[model samples]
Target chain A: MTRKIPQIICALFGMTLFLLYFSQHPTARNLNLTILNDYFQIIFAFTLLVGVVSFVKVNLKAFERGEDRSYHLVSVIGVFIMPLLAIIWGIKGDSPFMWVFENIQVPMQATVFALLAFFVASASFRGFRARSVQATILLAAALIMLLSRSTIGDMIADQIPQIADWIRNYPSMAARRAILIGIGLGSLTTSLRVMVGIERTWLGGDK
Target chain B: MDAGTVIAGILTLAILTFLYRDNPVYKLAESLLIGVSIGYFLVINWSNTIMDLMFVPLFTQGKLMLIIPLILGLLMFGRFNRKTTVLSRIPIAVLIGSGAGVAIPAMLDARTLQQMSATVTPILAPDGLPNISELVVMAGVITTLIYFYFSREHRGWWGKSATMGTYFLMIFFGTTFAYTVMSRMSTFIGRMEFLLSDFLKLTQ
Candidate 1:
């Protein structure tokens, strides 16, 4: 009963929304957009609670098991205190919550981001070895783009930017668009299947 | 130094610490990110859903019909309690139904149909150059699609065609990786700048 009911409901709702989107009526469009937006926001709210609970559960479990309990303590304390402070006192410029976020959160995200640079350098070194015609073209294109995007590119040759622009605007865009089109088709078919109740993995699993 | 500036500087330093190695500083930063993102999501939803959607329309415009969906939405919380969790199915059912009703036509109109239309373009124009770019795009699309056809063996022209398509696919992946790297490097740089300028006030 649980399985069948949700599947049917999803099929009905997906179809309605799909039709509403294509329909000419402003009222249908407005109703569909508004309701979906509402649902999205609700989902977001509940998901936040889920995240908090998950964090606490992991850290507390670690502490209980005597596994790297100190770091766990720091994480749990940080999570609870930072949000509590923000909620109670508000996140003004001088507030501790805002300070922690700007200092701690932003930097951490940036650090993860920075690791990608070294990864790229290593990958490029390995990737650009011109063992094939395709590899040679790729290496050439990357070199051109790198040079053209910088001031030194023009110092060496005036047409570097033009070449880069042509490569990006023509070949790269063409390939990307083709891939996007294929993806779009696949996504559409899946969406249709779900709407019709033929696909039901999203509501947990197929009934 | 100003408090805001100091905080920014510290964050910048913390970010830079990642380049050296994974440490307690990096972990602290990572945990905080998870915590704050979740918090931001919560606050955003509260304001957008509870205040804007449910309360405003119903109270001011007298759209009392909205109450049914509101009740259904609230019932989703029954998942927290074992005894009443089965009742959560009612709301889930409604969501599934509504979701399906919304997706089908849009998928057909926007994705499949439009994509097909885009592909049906002129391969050769009056000016003799044969629209080389369009020819390549068409060729790539055809070959790649053919490569995915699993019912038969990719032999002779089909095999050669799929092989050529794989080259294009590799190039695409490489370029994507390169761009991602650049983006990450810039992020790292931004963090470093914050630390130098804001935290230590070294550049004054």
Candidate 2:
């Protein structure tokens, strides 16, 4: 009964919401949006609980197995304690949670990004080799873009902005529009299949 | 330099040391990333979405009955236990239904009708220079659409059109790749500046 009832409710909810979204009725739209917003909030609340629980379970299992690098236990303790303190006391300006986030998360994210600078240089050097006419054109465009944005390039010549503008406005926008159109068509097709229940991947694994 | 900046500089140096070699320092930085991301997502989700949308709305309206969604949300945790994973389907179903409902009309208008109208704009506007751009766009669209048509052979004029269409497609794709590379480079440069200027305080 538990299983059957939930499935039925889900199917009905799905149909109603689907109808409401497409329906011209304002009331239906308002209700649908409100319900969605509420659901999003609840998911956010639950995800934190899930993360802590998962971390504890994993680390405990590691400890039981006597994993050699179990000093990762420090990280597990740090994770739970910091968040717990933040949640209980609330992180005001300069609070521990705020401090952890600003100092730890922001810096770490930035460092990872800094490493990507090396990747940019490497990927360009490797991939931008002009093996063909098409490759040559791409390298040219990339060179122009790189130069136009830098003070050194403008020092050499002043037409950099005008060239960059032309490339972005005409060629770039044209290409982006074409790709966007293709994406739109593909999405439409997928949505149609979903509405008809032909695309049941979203419902979970095949029966 | 301040104490905070010095500490930040050390962390930044430890991370950038990764470029020279994959050593213990890089591994430590990498491992912390996984833990920190999990923690950050959890906190940000709660603060941004839960407190603002769910809790506040429920508390203000005096609708203590809103606990139904909360329970439903909790039901998703059933997946943690193999035997009770079926219970998670309730919330998953609600999510799928809600998602499909919200996206359907918006998708139709944005993707189909608006796109078609945009493509079908008046080619030769009276005042414009015969609207060469529009003509080129229309040609590109029509021929490309033909290239994808599977029902018949593209011969003669159709063949030439499709060939021209292929060039247009290639040019479009090349532009996309270059732009993507540029955007990624900017992000990389921004991060380098954080390490060098803000964290290291080596550069102003």
Q: Which stretches of candidate 1 lie over 4 Å from their true place?
A: A91-100, A205-207, B56-62, B81-101, B124-128, B202-204
Give the number of the best model, judged by DockQ: 1
TM-score of each: 0.85, 0.83
lDDT of 2 by residue, A62-144 (tens): 86788734345545655665667578767687676776666666776777775776677787788779886656666776677
All models: lDDT?
0.67, 0.67
Docking class of 1: acceptable
Model 1: per-residue Cα lDDT over A1-207, one tens digit each: 866766666666666676677677889878777767766455445544545677788889999999877667766776677658768877677776666666556666666677678778887899889998878878877777777777899999999999877767655655565576667667667767766667766555323
**Candidate 2, which segments miss by more than 4 Å at Cα?**
A1-11, A24-26, A44-52, A59-78, A152-160, A203-207, B125-128, B140-204
Model 2 lDDT per residue over B59-122, tens place: 8977675677788778878879877777777776676656665566666678656756777767
**How displaced is residue B96 in candidate 2, in Å?**
1.5
